[model samples]
Target chain A: MTTSSYVYYPGCALQHRSHAYEVSNQAVAKALGIELVELDDWNCCGATEYFSVKRLPAYALVARNLALAAQAGTEELVVPCSACFLNLHKTDSHMRQHPRLEQAVNEALEAGDLHYKPGSVRVRHLVEVIINDIGFERLGQLVRRPLYGLKLAAYYGCLIVRPDNVLDDVEQPMLLDRMIEALGAEAAPFSMKTACCGGHMTQISETTALEMIHRLVTNASVSEADAMVTICPMCQLNLDVYQDAANRMFETSYTMPVLFFTQVIGLALGLSLEALGFGQEFVSVEPLIEKIRDVPPARSKPERRPKQALPMPAMPQ
Target chain B: MNATRPPTFFDRVVAATPDGERLSQCLQCGTCGGSCPSAADMDYTPRELFAMTMAGLEEEVLASNTPWFCVSCYACTVRCPQEIPITDLMYTFKQMAIEAKRFEHRSTADWSESFVGFVEQRGRSFELGLATRYHLFHHPAQVFKMGALGLNMLRHNRLALRPKSIRGIEQLRAILDRAKVLAEKEAWR
Candidate 1:
């Protein structure tokens, strides 16, 4: 059964680097009659780097958040960041899958006088809860202002739908597409919808990371999307902030606005731009905001050449 | 002719990873290699890396940049017909490489260390600190290049100048300390 209330785990990046996501997410949640209780004293989920550094310690670190969420008395723990969601969900399942790991992690948890069962608190991404719990039907009804004439490409970064195809189809997820359509926007056909955003590769390998980012933006441009709506901070940061770097490296001119899905949802809910953390983005979404219409575009047939008219002859050289 | 020989590098990797025995089931299929977005940048495709590991090429495997170039997108793991957990094995390989001090790129190691350092210090990661320290240590020239981006983040209020410590920091530290001991007991290093 889906619940209206959930324990929120705003991972470190969300609290600082992705504060806009947190603000817009909270506003959208409140408007939808969903209560998100912040898990008390929540620490880092160790991200991806920690696991590569220390495996057992990293599991224990992520399990700490799970232990806290379990103690918070909420049956579901909703996370905003894709990396955080993956770490929390992966650790929980790993503990259940491996007894030795479960015992070791539990022993570490004993230091804080906390213990967590693998399935005590269900780990979910914020997008998952919004799509599954409040649902598109209610979301459509709650749209105070439909975002018409706005072409949006739903970009789902790597971690959200991988390792386990729990949330959506691994190859071609439709939840993001459906949600965008529910917002009264055209969901452009994006081929690189589930491509990697290079994560920390930007810091690790500049050339390789920029090439990946270039592919994403170039694809979105080909689709003629007004903006690319993303569900993860790292994706947004890479596509928005590092876009200039990619342009410089590739010598291509591409202006694609990357935004958090919550911000887009907030706009549909009639929330103000400032309230939705609009200005926090590196790429200006102002032009795109002006494109939203009050009503959907009229359905009219495309103009065709006159039946009697002959095709234009090629100009003489 | 000996029936009992020491565990090969492949055996060590399989043993280190949870449910990693599936590594033996790898069909040398190119699904993982084809699915990887950064495979072009990798010195060896994941399939070739696996075969090399089975041949006990520890030095070449550890020093290769394939694992570090991985974005951890798990495109390979979810699609692996053998369910070999290719991504998890990547993580294991990264850890082993770190232990061997065979980092093909020093910046990758420094980046992870700084990230883990901040997490240990304040119970949460400080992005600004992590970035500043990493850039200053590894690529000082790139620091100036990233100056505008950093300032832009600051202007937008996305970058926090100060790190915030969680209320249960002491408890968190104790937990990490215990976990470290347990990790050592596992003999990972």
Candidate 2:
């Protein structure tokens, strides 16, 4: 049996912006006997821009971390942030394919007294690790309280699915949906699984960002999902914190809670809402909390009435 | 930056972009343009640019000043309903443009030159050198205004007066030269 242990790179957001993600991820991993080792002196993954701006430096930035992970003796690195995972994975792929880029980046690394050989460590998303390494069967076995009637819409976003190199099937990815179902919740059918959330666009431009967010939330809500479940911190923050603003911007009424997949796993493991960082969310999860314990009744159609009065009038005439 | 031979058209196209999918699935809903912070200020939309690229209207897309204006906030990529990687495409296009010598924003090129100079001299970015170069390029007057502040920062050891070179400067140069050659060849292809 492959033990559930891997190096965890929470990236920048989880460390500063979304502390709840980190706390919940750790608690859930610990409960599942998945040891998450933090990389020593790991720097930023350049937040998805540096590589595009300058290929060599971007490679160097990600390569520095890969070298650190290699030194830590971890064969695989588990990244929680979608952007970090993409950047790290892209760097690994590009370095192997482009020798000149690899040599240039390694030279930069040499300046910092660090060296990284291509394909030294495999970079993976937390969702991939949880779904592949920790099988759904094992997940179901660990579930202390099965969320029988809770409805969840799994949101994958773009980074994890697109480019197809670092991801699973782009058209239909069942990892998150499977995980949600394993937790004993009904995975609601929704179409915007691989859609973009207009990340940081919320900071740069609000109107367009809100619309993108609005579509995701409305789709999930219309699908009758109680909450939106996600794997990326950026996606979670965008959906959870920006839901109200997105609603106000679009002038629509939508009250949906965005919960991290780990948080849902934690809840299923009988962990308290506090430990899951449920209170830190901008949109109140109180309504979701109520639903968690009490499942809503299934919708039923009304019975049709008989048309006897019309027949009696016709006979009299 | 050292003067190098001009890149070929194909190399130019390849260098201008990061590795990613193109905008074949774009819905042309204008969401990317509408969401882009720089869209209001630019002549072309991200959708149009992608269309032109796919259509092989390379001259118009590459020659346009649109690529330089991208802030790289990834707003367009995120809001794209079709899941088109707009920002990455923009990056690729910009890189291709720079390598092809079609549209290198002088200001950004100057910054790149100064930054590379600093890195070649010092293993990492030197704050003073960076600030000096930035002021020289963007606003020379700011340097004079903050002279006293700059002296105070140096006195307090907040800024290093002498920039240190990386230990294997020769190897670093050789690596950079090889990258330049590869980029040139890629642009030509």
| Cα lDDT tens digits for candidate 1, A1-317 | 24477789988878878888988998988888888888998998888889888888899889999998888787889999999999998999989998888998999999999999998888899999999988999999999889999989999988999877779998899999999999999898899999999998888788999999999999999988999999999999899989989999999978789999999999999999888877777788889989988779874455888899798799899
CA displacement after TM-score superposition, residue B20 of candidate 2 (Å): 9.3
Q: Count the backbone clashes (under 3 Å) in each candidate.
A: 0, 13
Best by TM-score: 1
Model 1 clash number:
0
Q: What's model 2's lDDT at A36? A: 90
Which regions of candidate 1 fall more than 4 Å away from where they truly are? A1-3, A299-317, B1-4, B187-189
Residue A291 in model 2: shift from native, Å? 0.8
lDDT by residue (B1-189, candidate 1, tens digit) is: 466988789878997898889998989989999999999999999999999999999999999888888889999998899999898899888999888888576678778878999999999999888889988888898888777778988988889999999999989889989998988877432
* A52: Cα error in model 1, Å: 1.1
Across A188-299, the per-residue lDDT of candidate 2 in tens digits comes to 8887777777665553345657777888898998888999888887888778767877777788878888888899999899999989866667667788766664443454
True lDDT of residue A314, candidate 2: 50
For model 1, which pairs clash?
Answer: none
Q: List the lowest-lDDT window of 10 residues for candidate 1 chain A.
A: A1-10
